[model samples]
Target: MTKISQLDANDGRAELMTDEDVIARIFDHIDNGTTDRGQSSWKEPAVNYQSVDRLDAELALLRHRWIVFCPSSTLEKSGDYIARDAAGIPLIVVRGSDGEVRAFRNACRHRGVQVAKDEGCTSVFVCPYHGWSYGTDGSLRSVPNGDGFPGLEKETRGLVRVDCLEQAGLIFVRQNAGADRSESVPDMPDLIPDSFRVVKSEAMEIEANWKLHLESALEGYHIRSTHQTTFFPVQYDNLTVVEAFGENSRIAFPYQAIERLRGRPKTDWSANGRITYVYHLFPNVIISTFPDCMQVVVIEPLGLERTRQHMFLLTDCAEGGEVLEAVFKGQEFAAKGAIEDRDVVMSAQRGLKSGANDFLEFGLFESAIGRFHTVLKREIEIPAF
Candidate 1:
């Protein structure tokens, strides 16, 4: 019955349970063989996964919402830029010389081709198709054949800007071209510190519905069965502490090592490395924190049955080499569990095609997934203004 809210709060930081408090809960769950549960079960229709209309509706909501683009550390340098697809729009998030982050449509104004590909540092972006160049602030700087089009207005023909916001050390972008600038954005909790730096980044397309990937991330019910070989040995199965924050939620998965803090003094305890904190940002961002490192996973829907995962490995850059080595080791362990989860979701996607069940039933332990579906349903039902 203990919650993180009971833990002492740090100045200007979210309240978190001390190691002693969390250890007590772990023991309680072990004895009772029960985890945090929801008030009721949820039944989700299969059409939500197979219907093109449903997918379109979900995409519409995502377009207007502030989805995570990347971590602020990814654009640490003044000219660093990351080019990727958000929902379906090709977006380029770049840091200007003034240390401000901005996002814009990646397409070149001359033609419809993308101007930037992948990520790198550059003072100016030169289009590979033509010689059109743009500054870090997204202003047109040069054009090769300027005289070819006499009526071309360089000032107004710069890159099309997208709505961008940076908060809590994360970068977010709204893909809707005409989205209201004054629209209220969901507040993001401080999940990672400013000192964290992106140590590695990976991009891959998964053969599963984006929701399926999110469901896998939101609960620990599948650890014993799905991740038995990878995670179950070191982590308890079907045990988690879920806390809701607006449209988002945080699921705490404790490691077996948490037992070591049972008799430790409360003031001397830390949750770092002893618990895996998975923050599910409304819609499609997953920020997972381990003792040594943090990861940001952006789930972008490619189609009804396909999704692109942008994974970034982050660690405290100010730490020493030994600390970094431990962080990298922890990241590898997490990566293994991720691979196992991917395989399970891909299998579920294939099974859904068999028309075996009309709906998928989510139990109480999977409450976070139910909460996500509720938010998605509410957003889709909103009338367009």
Candidate 2:
């Protein structure tokens, strides 16, 4: 609860770091933060725990391989800012003064208290827990009572940085998942083209285990039946997988054309039915954006039965570019349809948690969702550690 000033009793000489230092700090966070800490929380990871199908669980667990933990995925769109500390839970993402990304544990190395709370950014992140202050570059530039803790490496003791990558307009963070780290990124970039970019994103929470919500996202088999009012009339062509990994599957669909839906408001046109390209990243993230057509990324876990979807609106047509209202409506309808999905995903989670359901079967066309589970089993239960 204390501010950095309180600890920086000799705060007179703390100078600001250079922009190049910030960039170097960005890479440093990625390479060095991998060192395992003894205590981190994982009570509700994205994997499904109750199911006997180790495959299902491992498929969800695979995404954890790339998580850099804490100081990764700096949210720049919100302006240069970072998530405070890990608090024993992974999720700090900060932007250095130079505008490069850096993620931290949100925890102060000294007292282990979170430096950033909720979401906020600062040029120099000073831990409120004590006077330990770090520049945007992750250097322990200032610390009060320099005489204490003899031999303490001020420069080396700054908060740890997690490994991260920004590709295809998306950020990837590396993680070990309680074991040794995974070497490659499963060739995710190859599956998607350079033409695609994350236009925008929002996180939505749903009720259910992370895996359960992911299962629902993996397949669109329940599209017609689950989203009756929103997409009942649209042709539910089933889901297709473009890539499958040890614990992840990438699926894409051809949503119906924008012009096809004739008589409807933009918001309700989702009922017109259209083809869509949806990508289900392994483990926790889903990049289900329809390039220039639609953009969305949904997270299936926040808490138990809680998931968040990062929604974005994309377009090839420039601002003021000529496009029919019907076309716009198609995208609108598509978003409406996804809202319907949240309800079904949440409901499915409730059913699974109930003892009444042993194991819900995936229809033939909805097989990718099952394959997603198969991948989960491979990654999570292994004892490679």
Q: If scored against the real structure, what TM-score would every candidate get?
A: 0.92, 0.66
Q: Going through the candidates in order, what is the number of backbone clashes in each?
A: 1, 58
84-117: candidate 2 lDDT, tens digit per residue? 2221244466666566665555568887876666
| Candidate 2's TM-score | 0.66
For model 2, what is the C-alpha lDDT against the true structure? 0.49
Q: What local lDDT does model 1 show for residue 64?
A: 76
List of clashing residue pairs for candidate 1: 273-291
**Over 4 Å off, model 2:** 1-64, 67-79, 82-88, 97-100, 118-121, 145-151, 177-184, 190-200, 237-248, 258-274, 291-293, 296-304, 308-332
| Root-mean-square deviation of Cα positions for candidate 1 versus the true structure, in angstroms | 4.8
lDDT of each: 0.83, 0.49
Every model: Cα RMSD to truth: 4.8, 16.5
